[model samples]
Target chain A: MSREHQKYRAPDALDHTRELLGKLAREVSVSDWHLVIEVRPDDLPEVALRLRDDETLSCKYISCIIGVDYVDWMEALYLLRSQEHAIPVRLRVRLDRERPEIPSVTYIWSGANWHEREAYDFFGIRFIGHPDLRRILTREDYDTHPMKKDAWPHRVRRTEWRWEDIERPKRLPGETDRRDRS
Target chain B: MSTVESKNDAVNPGSPVNQDGPAKPSFHLEEMILNMGPQHPSTHGVLRLVLHLDGELVVSVEPVLGYLHRGFEKLAESRTYLQYMAMISRLDYLSGFFMEWGYVRSIEALMGVRAPKRAEYIRVIIGELNRIMSHHVAIGDFMLNLGAVTPFFWVFRDREDAMDLVEMVTGQRMMYNYLRVGGVRWDLPDEFEAGCRKFIKEFPAKIDEYEELISDNEIFISRTLGMGIIKPYEALDYGISGPNARASGIDWDLRREVGYSVYPEFDFDVPLGQHGDCFDRYKCRIEEMRQSVRIIEQALDSICGGPVNIKLPPMIRPPAGEAYRAVETPRGEFGVYIVSNGGLRPWRLKLRDPTFSAISMIPKLTAGNKIADLVAIVGSLDLLMGGVDR
Candidate 1:
């Protein structure tokens, strides 16, 4: 009966002719329960800045920064909420799969530093201006970005425990892998 | 998995997590590095904090995580919708029901069906009890960090009674994988109402006892008051949620804000603190326990008779869409973001643990504080390594 009640509007997100967001929004759409404002990778910083400072759409609180790998392309979703309105906004930025890079919004929200590092650790996406862009969750020496779909080459949903399914580390140079015959 | 690093040389390789601070403490000439936990009890989980200290004062604290990472998110991509339900609770074991509730809420939202009225009320009832149970541990463990062993025992002793009530209904005390997509596993047993009512009735008195026992103590006041003050703006900037954020005067609670489940039907108050400090955090939690008791009593009074679960096909696949559903867990806003590609299994499932955001701010919060106060501050945050490491 009502479109206002149906689709979640993020301040002036849907309308692209207004001001700051209007000049930047590449593709404005709605997803699930959020006003999904798709912006260019380079424009992520500006878009985030306005989203935080704009009185109407003051999206100051960022809940999560999710990075998704679609095999062909990469997407970074920022879940934002405003305390004044409690309206949730999703800033979706598409990245090149070959060299997935996005301007970090860490400057806007300090909390995004750790989240950006986590995305960098998992998806191998680089945040251009991230001061501490090191891996947050995985060991720095670990080569594989485990969250990527291709990370697990031979991922078998093992129904029963198999001795071969378990990966064992090789013994140290001098330490022998002695096992009793029993 | 809790890797409590020793006094020095705790950094894994090349000192990855621990970077040198910008404003280095020049007074000491060299920052004395100290490692608190990957194994310390106060750490709560496998969390290693590499603290750079000048004498007894912490210059900068770097938290090293992933010691307890089990790759639960990757596991969800392979398992079907039903199969993944079993492990969601493991995301935050203290309030496993909330974890399960968050995941199932997204699935149910995607399918466009709410659980029957009775089922919702039952969830509210169980969820509040679980909140009290979790806060018990948070309070007890916080007291333990302050070196008060008696309050820890007191909270634990009462926690067992609350756990017994949950066990009677869910068949498990801690890891209650009892929440299904459309509704709960089963309706409340006949005796549960009487027992739960008794717990809620006595629960308020128990909360009062706890407040009287620990709240006014001089040691606790001195240790917590004006220590680790999280400015409201800073709290919002860091994405802190639940009691921690409320203690900082944010006033954002998903149960009240999102109105998920039957929370809107309840009559309760979300206690907020004026000063966002360690003491306020503890007080907010204690007040929340009382509010939980209020919700439980209301739910018990209004719970109606109906089927707890809805009928669904053996093999179910949600349409290709994305949904995010968060619940006001004891810890914070525990949200489950699910992306279904019209498959039996989800394409991607992100279990957002509130502890991740809380832990990210640890280095900022504990800096300049003495090592003893660092324990007090960290304890007040009520961080669980199981959730953060995930």
Candidate 2:
């Protein structure tokens, strides 16, 4: 009935308190009948699996996965949804920026492959269990994570090159190569 | 060939694909790596596809993006809430209006605000109209991919009229950032409604003409009907939405499922496909355009008299919370996740860009597909690289 309650009530969210407490012994409650798992980085992968496989919390759809940088501490938020019940569970994991490594959820949600790559691309957070980690949406050679506060301004190249300057060369008969002959 | 000689003389071994002989091994297979473009015209934009090919057959494709990154999300972080609203139009420049509307709506939802009822109705109308235009270009590109250039011209002729109507309403034809935080930037002028009605009235017959020109053509059907198939289950697993998901027989549409704005009031059918192939996807989009016309007609009747925008401060600093709002754009489910730390600028703004997920299914879709089918399949996905590489 309350706004706080409506925030968690989508249609099918798992309220996993007893099971989460059994694993991490962290305080968990059912707000709007949806599970809010507040866990450390180490328990993330395991907790993710529990919510994914358990019928009551079959968070089959990984609706959204995001990362927040609090300078000293970084948090990865996984918003999982159940198709049957139509409820969404909010899984939050806090990690220290110095050692920003956590088990990947690629196995759980194939969609997370790109999402994790983006998080890693922007926040420099590493997903240890990720299958293929590459610099996506940015040049592979580009270094600084631009999303970071300390990042230098992105390189700017001002050019006055004309279209005539970049035309392809034509070839002549019996040429060593079209380019070479040119 | 003085031009040729001069061009070649000025170049180093800059043609990465041309200079490398047959022996230079690429990543996988015995296939050669063909760098398609950062310049080729058929690429649609400055896209480079690192194609691992065993002759004409594509062994694998590694699409390289960010040629048009422009750092849009990062740019939004520094600009004022109102100013940042303008940049969204350029993200998926093809589906410009949808991107702008989705972006503003996400910010609005996070702020726990809604546009006035009149604004919602207008948003639905223009958004649907934009969806029709986006689909026309997509259909055009898909036809062109299959080597039909005439259909591209034919579709664009109709598309141009749609663009004209859009121009009257929001001044700029293509990248109209007409949507504002609380409401639209401007209300519809008297001519705007008349122009739209005329376009909507004539659009159905034009669509029929398009079908007669190409859709039922033996060559078009043969090339597209069975090519590039991905089942419904696989589509859902890959998080495919919009036309791509609907093409695969999944009845998931954000407009119907979530009921974001006044979409609930409009009576329209959500078309489905039994076989998720390039052909079905193409059909789904065409049909969607038809449904969009109906929605426009219904919206036009209700566009009586009321405020176009909600009453909100010129500057918006939303509460410390986050909201993810997904919309059924022409491409697919265009979602925006906005996190506000009670600041003028969003603490975080990430998009569940349909093109990103749609493009991911490319490898699976194109696995056994021939080189000719490559462009057809790619165009059918109707990706916005700006959305993908953002």
Candidate 3:
């Protein structure tokens, strides 16, 4: 990095956030230079409110909410940014594979309402208190949350798309094991 | 219930409208439910707005989406990194360059690579040109929504010039998938710089003409000045970004704040609005077009000769990691988030479209406005469903 080309930012931006975050975050680390905080599903709302209302880490802009299904576990990622700091702060919440749910942060940031609904629509991760937690993109009656790993065709598996080896493709939770997917 | 009563049924139970029955024909005692386009002319795409109306005033608006949902996020899980680049531009066809740029930036970051200096400059040139083209549609469509037809035709006349320059370099007018992972597909064509210089030199005069046509016109000002006001806090609270957030006097622009790519090297200014109304949003786009012109001039002057792309194998696998990289498109900050599991395809790829945030805030912003103003407000916000549905 060149000296004159780079703009000024806090040297230990992550530490400042760590101190402010206090005990709310179960784990704090860096990913791609962005501060990532792992919090329990229940602590999500409190952690989000602190991030928004805090002075140094005023992460007001809600960039995106991402949901991932890893077969064994599901992940929800909230990417936020502070206009002042120019540093992105990510909140990672892991949930049970059978019932992936977390407290909603829509009250903290109104923009999260749609993002949370989108997460619910795509990954079947329930945002516990979202006012209108319905499908945002897909049709409301769409049977499956298509982003889940097991939402793949009954012939194709998640990690390995070896259609020949498996007699039955993995089915989503609460779904019948019938191989009707043609 | 009879035909008259069914037509005037209560849309919201507590909105000073009687739910028991339609009481009077003098002024309808029940709220009327108005369903606007999955086909209306003003709505830019197949966006459906279910507006709860009491006479001409809107009680509440429930925007029904997914009419054009093509499953962009779900489709990414099956495509390889290189295969996905071709589809990113389709997210927002108006600002396709920025979409490709955002996608390539994240992949390059995941692989710890940077495009050559020449490639970066070329990217900036094409990107700003794309920005001008997008703002053209915004201003044209905004005027069209306001019942003005001349500006729409005028912007289309000028947009063709910018498209020609883009076509020369990228070979496609709309879906120019020119940006590659490491750098770009190729170096700038010999005629691109000269043609770009000619366009920038004359572009300012064309902006002045658009200003002359609509800036001080009585009808335009009366309709837009204080309509659809988004407070500064509301802009932040709703996650609005790009010109819509900047128009609200939020004082944030990713190009200046984050200063990614080669934006910092050039000297330019970001315009801010005072009232955060429809006028400010329109004014912000006009001023942004000027600023984009300035960026093109500076980039053209400073561009240096170098190898355009660094050759890597056709099939590339970035190390398992997650990265979020956003670029300031004309609408707002268009971001691409990628999570790889050391595999051929992304485990999760989320396209954070700025228009989605803009659309979500519509129900809050449009309440209590006249149906006419609702048209003005939606048009002024410059809604594009391509990216939002994705």
Candidate 4:
């Protein structure tokens, strides 16, 4: 709650963010405040817990977690928040394509459970220590995770059988129905 | 707070293993793994929850997602900046206005552009109306989940009325992509004011109907009153927002705290709850709908006549920077984080679904409750799987 640049409290949120970040982590250069934490894969969950629990850094809320598939590795970016201080923290965890696994922070904040699961199911990142880590929003029998950049499904043409043509009656009960054959 | 410290007795304390094998020595009870959904109506979507059940009590819930993954973010990377606006509506199908508003606000923040005063007024009016509509459906769905059939019909009946009002203005019922980069797509039609006025005047009484029907019903209270209780500290820690946070006695609303657009111009109250529980969450929503009606009335009275949209170039390429915009959706705080590359397409676009935190709160809320209570807790969260899975 360090008040410095309260003018952009509502409007011009970016400037407000820059000033707040400057106040929080004094060592972080103002220029590099946007991309704050460059964390290793294994260290991410621990860092996240500290951010959520430590009184000095109670960033208890994870606003969003996104996964981007780059050519070399998959990048998982988390946007977190501290409503009391009105500050936002950005954390990144990049995993190589060969072995994409990271610990789950769902234990720290229960809200991260489904989000982490979604990231794992779609991006193919194995969430180590995730309780009941299973596919959620996908079809039960669907073979592939649709969002994975590397995987592509074989598309097939849809077939529809019309009932009118297939069940054409041979004889009508009364007068002969108009029969037109071409 | 420390009570939740999980014991290794329930699960193996050894290193996490990915292989399918016999139960380890540390594993005490043999838990049955069950797939909750793919087609089950309770799940609300194709969402499949892999559950480890110790009889009826759930030991763990593993959520599998991507059934409704339209790859919106991936698709946005290829599309032009302005074109991506249309796609935001599809991310959270339930509350499209918030999704659109969040994206536009982010773009405006990055580009340093502001909507006109009149446009801002309209934005508040329409956004609040959208909130009301969302709550209607949410309450209805919640009631349905609680095994209450009458409330769902009654809630949706009013929700349709709100949808009719939206359709008249935008010409689209569900996904009204009426929000533009700097403002709205069009001005409110002549009948729009009258329609809104009619709704605002009658909405309070209709809410009374909801109270008499559901709120006063002893069965509803027994199902919800004390179930899924959350404290303010826990609510904040878990990143719960909107009605969910308010139910926990947290008196914070982005509409008031953040005060984006012309929200400050209108006089309205941010509802708070004394106890955070399923009942409080339910009451918070009903009260919010009332507040929305009040806000709409104020905005309409102060609504000035002018161009609804701001003029901007067809191709939008903001300077290289990042912008994050948060809006109070019915579920919670809906945020959009966008990274611009000073090009037609954005470097990265991420949507923060409010339901994500609410979903995470599920285990906490339902851990000790009966199986029936779990259904009530899920409904109380009022999640949209589209946004969660997107």
Q: Which candidate wins on TM-score? A: 3
Model 1 TM-score (2 dp):
0.90
Candidate 4 similarity to native, TM-score: 0.78
Q: Encode model 3's per-residue lDDT on B1-390: one tens digit a residue.
A: 575655454443433556466554444567899999989978888899999999999999999889989889888888998898899899888999999999998888888888888888889999999999999999999999899999999999999999999999999998999999888898788888889999999999999999999998999999999999999988988899999989999888878877787888989999999989999999999999999999999999999998989888899898998888888999999888888898989988989999999998899888999999999999999999999988
lDDT string for model 2 (B1-390, tens) is 965554453453454434554433233224667887767555667767777778778878877767887877677667677887678877888888888778887787777677788787888888888898899988888788778899899888888898888888889888897888788877888888888888889999988888788778999899888888878667655667788889989787767766677777779999998899888998998899899999999999987578887778878888887776677788887777777789888877777788877777677677555677787788778876777777
Superposed on all Cα atoms, the candidates' RMSDs to the truth, in angstroms, are 8.2, 11.4, 7.2, 9.8
Error of 4 at B336 (Å): 1.4
lDDT of 4 by residue, B1-390 (tens): 332233342265442442356545543355778887767777776666677777777776655556677777667776787688778888788789889998998898899888887888887887888898889888988898888889889988888888989898888887888888888888888899999899899889999999999999999998898888888878876778899899888877887766777776778898998888899999999999999999999998998877777789989888898777789888888888787779888877777888767776676667645567777877787877888767
- Tens-digit lDDT track for model 1 on A24-79? 88877655657778899988888889889988778888899888888889889899
Docking class of 2: incorrect
Q: Give lDDT per model, in order.
A: 0.85, 0.76, 0.88, 0.76
State the fnat of model 2: 0.28
Candidates in descending DockQ order: 3, 1, 4, 2
Judged by DockQ cut-offs, the docking class of candidate 4 is acceptable
Separate DockQ for every predicted complex: 0.41, 0.20, 0.44, 0.27
Comparing 2 and 3 by TM-score, which wins? Answer: 3
Please identify which of the two predictions, 2 or 4, would achieve the higher DockQ against the true structure: 4
Cα deviation at B189, candidate 1, in Å, is 0.7
- Which parts of model 3 are misplaced by more than 4 Å? A2-11, A155-182, B1-26
DockQ of 4: 0.27
**By summed lDDT, which 10 consecutive residues of candidate 1 chain B come out lowest?**
B5-14
Best candidate per lDDT, number?
3
